[model samples]
Target: MQNSYPNRQWIYVKRPEGRVGPEHYELREEVLVGNLAANEVIVRASIISVDPYIRIQQHERNTYDVPHPLGIVQRAGVVGQVVASASPLFAEGDWVSTYSGWQLYARCHHSELTKLDPSVAPVSTALGVLGMPGRTAWFGLMDAGRPRPGDTLVVSGAAGAVGSLVAQFGKRAGCRVVGIAGGPDKCKFLTDTLKLDEAVDYRAYSTLESLSDAIQAATGGVDVYFDNVGGRVTDAVIPLIKRRARIVICGAISQYDGGLDKPDLGPRFLQHMLFQRATIQGILARDFINRMDEMVATVAPWVRSGELHFHETYVDGFDELPAALNSLFDGRNLGKLLVRV
Candidate 1:
């Protein structure tokens, strides 16, 4: 390794207004001139996740790590291999994944990482199915939503990373699965690929009325609804929920474009929960990390046996991460979105 390194990164250009575009972020190049400190290691990124939180925050508001101010490198989760190490557990050739955000190389404290076991799980799994998004699905379904046999489970953004896995996991628990997505291809994926009991295309339906009608037909009535996209989708389904239903608020990709606004039939739906004795809870997966081993155990065998399916769209190269993520916001990709470093 060289004594000095040059790293290229994506920087926040300005605070976004409404619909975010390329102009919101700027690709900046910087030179890194350093060596590892005693408890630190240097890693070259292998894969990075293009997630919603990166776009939701202002140039000054970060979700996982600290925010990246305007004209500065952005923060995101990354999977990498250590090229040089000064820590006891991490050594040269060690492969691990972390919350490095969006950068080509990382110099971080060794205590901040867990060594990746390539023999047990594929390296890319750290970014998608076997990692954060997968964990989010597992934690949300089991703890918050708690679907059971014969229960009707509905997941919004059903073809997405967290949504796809949540639907599959709910299926494994013996609940009937219904998915909602933006396009026909994604709708097909929920049925043909993920094998959920039913799928609804939000675009074809147009209004909240049609979407509610389609979901009503699929679920009969949902016992649990895993909400990833908020806006109209939530408005469409909330009133149709079964008595004593549970709603897990995961990510609101729908509302992230702009914070909450008055809804079409918004004020009317909260009474449905009260009348039916249902529960609605918002979740952040990190709150359940202590159960990581349990999540791994729950999904690992299914992953190996091909019983549980994880779908991801990979865009190679460190440079391709952002645009790949933009595709997600535009509903252009299905399943989990991943970047191959």
Candidate 2:
């Protein structure tokens, strides 16, 4: 390997007001001083994730994650190969997953990384199906939503990384799974590829009433609602929830583009929850970190055997991170969006 190279990184330049753009981040380069401490390793990033949560994290007022500061390497989930190691836990050429951000290379402690076994699945799966997104779907749906046999499960943003797996898990549990996505192609993939029982095209319906009508027809009434997109989709699904329904709030991608400042004028759907005695819960994968191994054991086999399906949209180059993230809000990406570094 070369002694050193320019470490290109995307730095947070400004707090986004409404929609995030390339202007919010700046690509900067610095010399990577190739040196390691006793417990440190230098990793060359292969893939970096660009997720909706990153937008929320960049906001000035955020609850889920620490607000991103300006002039810092933009934090993200990454899969990379260890190029140099000073720790016994890792060796040169070992694949690992970590929060190494949007940089081409990272220097991290051995303890901070999870070694990836390429024999189990592709290393890129560590950032998508087998990594945080997969864990989010597993714990959020199974633990929080808790769909049962004969139940009707409905997922918003069902073509997305977390929602896609949530739909599959619901199906595996014998629930009638219905997915909601933006375009016809995504809706088709949800049904044809993901094997969902039904797919709802949200873009086809111009009004909430129409959307609700379509959802109501698809699955009599949702017994488990795994919500990824909030706003109108949530509004449409609210009234259709059956008695004793479980609503899992995994993400609110629809509201991210507008930021948290814009007041939501939607009806008080909490009233519906009170009447139906439904359960609503918000989930974060980090909260269930201890159970990740169990999740991998359960889901990995299905993935390996071709029972579980995963899709990824790869935007090549380290500088494309901004455009990759923006694609999420526009519903341009059909699956987990990653930047190939």
Candidate 3:
């Protein structure tokens, strides 16, 4: 067996001013020796994930967690296969998911890995629908949004990863689901593919008032708002809340560029909360990590029987990691954005 293997990694080198792309990362190659401590395994990355939260962590100041420290492999989730192992729990050719970031190869302790069974679902789904995004969508909507039968649920960033799932789940809960996305193509996906009741294209309207009007027309009045792209879209959704509405703050991809450090405040929709007696909650996937088995058990059956649809936008090659992440902000992806390594 080879004692060492050549590996490629994307290192976060610089903070972004507006948009995060190749300029902020450094791609370097190194050799990894096969020596491992007890309970350690070497895995070769097969798929890597690019998520919006990565940009949030890039902010200089802390938000939900501390800022991502500079000069490290850009943090991400990876689905890979074990090539060598020193742990009883893992073996060569076993598939696993790990927080091994942007590296093509990583030596990880068995504890840091979650063994994946290809027979269950696609291993790449570990980085997507069956993974963090799924957890966020499930808990954020069911627990926080609390959609009921015949309720109007409005989802921003509806064509994207978490938003798409939230829209479908809202439909499953017997709600009237309206999806708000960037362009006509994504809107089409929301209505035609995901089968949402209505799909609004936020980009068509140049002002908040116009966007708000569009959403109001589609939803009539919102009983639940699942927000992923904040800013103007959020401003638009707030006033449309019906009595006892619930708002689940899942993400704010619109402001992730630089607004987290210096926010751009919008309309004071807090008055809407007062009028409607609505509940607003900010949910993170980490909060529901303990209940992962509950989510998988409930949602995995839908995945296996094709009762749920998972759309994946794949960017071929590990080298496309930074670019794929940047494309997220541009609304270039349909569902989960992934890099096939």
Over 4 Å off, model 2: none
Question: Which prediction has the highest TM-score against the true structure?
Answer: 3
Cα misplacement distance, residue 173 of candidate 3 (Å): 0.5
Give one digit per residue, the lDDT tens place, for model 3 in 1-341: 35687999999989897899999999999999989889999999999999999999998877888988889999999999999899999999999999999998999999999999999999988988899999999999999998899999999999999999999999999999999998999999999999999999999999988989999999899999999988999998999899999999999999999888888988787888999999999999999999999999999999999989999999999888898899999987899999998
- Candidate 2 least-lDDT 10 residues: 258-267
Tens-digit lDDT string for candidate 1 (208-246): 788789889888998999999987889889988888999
How would the candidate models be sorted by TM-score, starting from the highest? 3, 2, 1
Candidate 2 per-residue lDDT, tens place, 1-341, comes to 33575799999899888788799988899988767878989999999998888888887875687688788998999999998888899999999999989899888999999999998999999988898999999999999998899999999999998999898999999999999999999999998899999999999999999999999999899899999988999999989999999999999888887646675688788888998999999988898889999999999999899899899888998878898888889987877888888
Provide the overall lDDT of each model, using Cα atoms, as 2-decimal numbers.
0.81, 0.90, 0.93
Off by over 4 Å in 1: 59-68, 260-267
- Per-prediction TM-score: 0.93, 0.98, 0.98
lDDT score at residue 37, model 3, on the 0-100 scale = 85
